[model samples]
Target: MDLLSDSALMLKVKSGDNHTLGLLYERYKKRLFGFFFQMCKDASLCEDLVQNVFIRVLKYKHTYTEESNFLSWIFKIARNVYYDHFKAAAKNKASDVDELYDLKSSDNVEKEMEQNEKMMLLKKAISKLPDDKKEIILLSKIKGLKHKEIGEVINCSEGNARTRVHRALNDLKDIYLTLEKR
Candidate 1:
């Protein structure tokens, strides 16, 4: 038999077939993990957030509508999960710091070092972005979301989303250049 659509599987999940929820998890796990990892750069935390997203999916399956785009709906949940985590962590602690990415060892040590330096600079630049700008970049550039979809998630018009993404890119470019020059 053919694989069911995400909405179909989700409907199954809504109807009390919990097994279908597993199928939905399997389908979205990688993408959701990538989204979370790019935002926070923490493997362990990303794993937790991805689990939480699936949990929320099961928890709120009844709220999902057939007319809505499944990907957008799930991403909305993912965004809320992230904000909830952020807020909770903020309340528990004064600061939330993310560690830099680890670089792999290679035979060309100089090249590896230079590449790692560039990656570190890029990540730092991205980290410095205001939350709104960073989120737009992650959703549009990193997650490969369309302007319309991004607008839906961010609660803006499509044109506004496009404009915000453009400005964010320009800001990121400036920041990256400044960091590179150091």
Candidate 2:
């Protein structure tokens, strides 16, 4: 079984193949953990959240539809989990923080550090954007999703997704330029 293709694995998983589900979990665990880490900024909490996502997937395997992209379906669950975490954190009066990527063992740590610094600046600039623009940029640039994939995730048409991404990129560029002048 090819583990990387989510749809095929999902079909198997839905058909009483527990091993296929395990394969899917192994394939996505690291990337989804990284995504949650970036979103929630707490390694331990992100770990729990990632586990929760997989657990929920297991518990709700029967709920998955054939027409849905498996990746989008999983991400939608992750998004919901993040929102719940966000709300609970807000209620606890915790400050929202961005998690910085660890590059401690990179060959060129200095250059990596410099690049990460720039990325932090870009993240800050992106966060200042409106919600729709921020979502579009994050989905496209950070998640590396195609326009059609993004549309599937966001429940919009592909054309709308493309236009949204283009406008968001333009707005982000303007923001970056403004920040450069300051």
Q: How high is each candidate's TM-score?
A: 0.82, 0.71
- Kindly provide the TM-score of model 2 when superposed on the true structure, using C-alpha atoms: 0.71
Give lDDT tens digits, candidate 1, residues 1-182.
Answer: 55999899898888999888888898889998988877777789999999999999989988988886788788889999988998887532222323455556667788788887788777778777777688788788635479988887878899999999999999998999997887
Model number with the top TM-score? 1
Each candidate structure's count of clashing pairs = 0, 0
Which candidate tops lDDT? 1
Error of 1 at 146 (Å): 1.1
lDDT of predicted model 2:
0.73
Instruction: Report, for every candidate in turn, its global Cα lDDT versus the true structure.
Output: 0.82, 0.73
